[model samples]
Target: MILIADSGSTKTDWCVVGNSGKVLSISTQGINPLVQSENEVERVLRAELMPAMTYISDITDIRFYGAGCRDEMITVLERLLRKVFPAAVNVCVYSDLLAVARALCGKNEGIACILGTGANSCLYDGEHITANTPALGYILGDEGSGAVLGKLFVNALFKGRLSDKVRTAFEAETQLTMPVIINKVYRQPMPNRFLASLSLFIGRHIDEPDLHRLVVDNFRSFLVRNIRPYCRPDLPVNAIGSMAYHYRECLEEAARAEGMRIGTVMKSPMEGLVRYHSDI
Candidate 1:
C-alpha cells in the first residue's frame, strides 16, 4: 500500500492506494505544522488519521506532502509518522509544493503556482524543480492569496475607500468593530490569517464590480511580483488553490495583461494527486 498526503494551512487531504493502484480511502484533517505545535500535530494525526486508517494495519510505504513542514518541523513530523505507522517500511515527508508540482505538471515541464492563504511558484521540468520564487508570508508578500486580498480589503475599509455596502457586509460577516480589528492586527498574532479570513466576504461579492477590481488588483500584483519573475512572458502557467480556482477569470485576465497564458486552475490537489500517484 502507498499513502499520500497533501496538506495546507487549513486542511490535510490523505489518500491510501492499494497494491493494485486502487484508492482504498480518503481522509481530511487540520494538520498545518507551521501553525500547530508538535503536540498539536500529533493530536490531530492520532484523532484524525489513525481512525481513518483503522482498517489497514499493514502499510508498506507513506509519503506526506504538507505545508509548514520546513526545517525542524519536517524532522518532527517524520518522527511522529514513524511512530504512528510502525509497520510501514518507508516514509517520506516533504513540502506541500511537491504535491502541487506533481499534480499540476506531473512528468511534463510547466509553471506551477499556489494561491491560497499564501502564494508560491516554481518552474518544473518533469522530475525536478528548476526554480522557485520566495514566499514571504502574508505580511511582507503572498501577493495573490487570500491573506493579501484581506490585507487590501482591510486597508481600504479603514481608509474609507470602500463603499457603504461593502462596509456593511464586512461588518455583518465578522461582527467585529474597527477598533477590534485594529487591535487584533496590531497586537495579536497571526494577523495575516485573520485578514485572510476576510476574503470570504470578498468572495461573496465577486460579481460586484468594485469588489472584483480589488480581487483582480491583488491577484495581478501576486502574478507580477511572484510568478512573472520566474516565468517567461509566454510560458503557460497552471494554478492550484481555492482563491485561484474560484477567481480563474480574473487571474486569466491579469495573466493576459502581462502577456502570459493561464493553463489549468485546480481547486483541490487531492484528487489530482491521487490520480498522479496511482499512475506512479
Candidate 2:
C-alpha cells in the first residue's frame, strides 16, 4: 500500500492506495516541522493521525508533500513518521510546490503555482523543478495567497482607503475592533491563519467593487512578482489552491493582461495526486 499526503498550513489531505485501487482518503491536522516542535508532531500523530489510520500496518510506502518542508524539516518529519508509522518501510518528504508541479503539469513542463494559506511558484520540466522564486512569508510577501489578501483587506479598512459603507460592513462581519485587530495580529500564534480567515468575507462580498479591486490587485502582484520572471511565451501556467480556484475570474484577468494562459486550477491536489502516485 502507498500513503500519499499533501499538506498546507491549515490541513493535510491523505490518500491510501493499494496495487488494485484506493483504500481510503482522510484528512488530519497539518504538520509543519518548521513551525511545530518534535514533541508537537508526535502529540498530534498520537492524538489525531495514528488512531485514524485503520490501514496503518498495510502502508509500505509513505510520500509526504508539505508547506515549509525544507531539507532540515524533511529530515525532522521523516524521523517522526518513522517513529509513528513503524510498519512503513519507505518514507519520503517533498515540498508542496513539487506536489503542484506533478499534480497540475503531470509529465509536461509548465509553470506551477500554489496560492493557498501561502503562495509559491516554480518552473517545472515535468519531473523536476528548474527554477523558483522564493515565496517570502505572508508578512514579507506571498502576494496572491489567502493570508496576503486578508492582510490587504484589513490594511485598506484601517488606512481609511475603503469607503465608510464597506468599513462598517467589514467591522460588523468580522466583529473586529481596532484593539482586537492589533492584538490578533501582534500577539497571535498563527497570524497567517488569523489573517486568512478574513478572506472568507472577501469571497462572500466579491461582487462589491472595492473588494473586487482588492482581489484583482492581489493577483496582479502575484503575476508581477512571482510568475512573470519565470514565464515563457509558449509554456502554460497552472495553479492549485483555494485562492486561485475561488477567485478564478480575477486570476484569469491578471494572466490575460500578462499575455499568459492558465492551464489548470485545482482547488486541491488530491485527485491529481492520486493519479500521479498510482504508478509509483
Candidate 3:
C-alpha cells in the first residue's frame, strides 16, 4: 500500500492506494504544521490515520507533503510520522509546495501557485523547484490571500472607504462593530486566520460590484507581488488551492489583465499525486 498526504494551513487530505493502484480510502483532518505542534500533529495522525490503515497491513511506502515542514522542522515531522506508521518500509516528507509542483507540473516545467489561507509560488522544472517566492506567512506578505482580502474589506469599512449602503450591509451580515473587529485583530491569536475567515462574508456579497472589485484588486495584487516575480511574464501558470479553485474565473481574469496565461486550477493536489506516483 502507498500513502499520500497533501497538507495545507487549514487541513490535510489523506489517500491510501492499494497494490493494484486502487484507492481504498480517503480521509481528512486539521493537521497543519504551521498551526499545530508536533505532539498535536501526532495526536491527529493517530486518531485519523492509524484507524484508516487497518484494512491494509505491511504498508510499503508513505509520502507526506505538508506546510511548515521546512529546514529543522522536516526532521521533527519525519520522526513523528515514523512513530505513527511504523509498518511502512519507506517514508518521505516534503513541503506542500513540492506536492503542488509534482501534482500540477509532473514532468513538465511550469509556474505553480497556491492561493488559500496563505499564498506561495514557485517555478518547477519537471522534477524539482528551480525558483521560489517566499511566502512570509499571513502578516507581512500573503498579499492575494483570504487574510489579505479580509483585511482590505475591514479597512475599507472602518475608514469610510466603502459606501454607506455597503457598510450597513456588511455590518448587518456580520453583526460585528468596528471596535469588536479591531479587538479581534489586535488582541486575538492567529489574527491573520481570523481576518481570512472574513472572506466567507465577502463571498456572500460577491455579486455586489464594489465587493467584486475589491476581490479582483486583491487577487491581482497577489499575482503581481508573489507569482509574477518567479514566473516569467509569458509563462503559463497552474494553481492549486481552495481560493484559486473556487474563484478561478476571477483569478484568470486578473491574471489575463497582467499578461499571464492561466492553466489548470485544482483544489486538492493529492489526486494528482496519486496519478504521479502510479506512473512511477
Candidate 4:
C-alpha cells in the first residue's frame, strides 16, 4: 500500500491506496513544519489519524508534501512519520509547492500557483521547479489569498469604502464590531485563519460590483507579481486552492485581461496526487 498527503496551513488530505485498488481516506488538522512541532505532529498523527486507519502493515511508502518543509524541517517530519508508521520502509517529505507542481502539471511542464490562505507560484519544468516567487506569508504578500481578501474587506470597512448598506450586512454576517475586530486581528492567535474566514463574505456577496472589482484586482496583482515573471504562452498556467477554485470565473476573467492562459483550478491536490503515486 502507498500513503500520500497534501497538507496546507489549516488542513491535510490523506489517502491510503492498497495494491489491489482498495482505498481509505481521512483528513486531519494541518501539519506544517513551520507551524506545528515534531511532538505535535506525532501526537496528532498517532491520536487523530492512525486510530482511524485499518491498515498499516502493507504500507511500504509514504509521501508527505507540506508547507514550511525545508531541509531541517524535512528531517523533523521524517522522524515523526517514522515513529508513527513504524513498519513503513520509505518516507519522503517535500514542499507543498512541489506538490502543487506535480498535482497540476503532472509530468508536463507548466506554471503552478497556490491561492489558499497563503499564495505562491513557480515555474515547473515537468519534473521540478526551476523558478519561483516567494510566498512572503500573509502579511507582506499572499495576494489573491483568502487571508489577504479578508484584510482588504476589513480595511475597506474601516476606511468607509464599503457602502453603508453593504457594511451593515457584512457586519451582521460576520458578527464583528470595530473593537472586537481590532482586538481579534491584532492580539489573537491564528489571525490569518481569522482573516481568511471573512473571505466567505466576498463569495456570498459576489454580486456587488465593488466586491467584484476588488477580487479581480487581487487576481490581477497575483498574476502581475507571481505568474508573469516566468510565465509563457506555451506553458500552461494553473492553480489549486479553495480561493482559486471558488473564484474561478473571476480568475479566468483576470487571466484573460492579463493575456495569460489559465488551466486547471482545482480546490485540492489529492485526486491528482493519488493518480501520481498510483503510477509510481
TM-score of each: 0.88, 0.91, 0.91, 0.93
Model 2, 53-114: lDDT tens digits are 88988988898998889987888998888898898999999998899999998888889999
Residue-level lDDT of model 3, residues 17-51, one tens digit each, is: 77677566656675666668888889888877777
Best by TM-score: 4
Candidate with the larger lDDT of 1 and 2: 2
Candidate order by lDDT, highest to lowest? 2, 4, 1, 3
Give the least accurate 10-residue stretch of model 4, judged by summed lDDT.
228-237
For all candidates in order, the CA lDDT equals 0.82, 0.87, 0.81, 0.86
TM-score of structure candidate 4: 0.93
Tell me the tens digit of each residue's lDDT in model 1 across 16-76. Answer: 8776665566566767777788888888888888876744566787889888777678888
Worst 10 residues of 2 by lDDT: 228-237
lDDT per residue for candidate 4 within 1-280, as digits (tens), equals 8889888767888899876553899999988888777788888898889988888887888999997898889988998888888999999998999999899988888899999787899998887889998878889998989898888888887898988888988878878898998898899998998888887888899889878888888888899988887847677679998889999999988989999878988888888887777777
Lowest lDDT block of 10, candidate 1: 19-28
List the candidate numbers ranked by TM-score, top first: 4, 3, 2, 1
Model 1 earns a TM-score of 0.88
Runs of candidate 4 with Cα error greater than 4 angstroms are 20-22
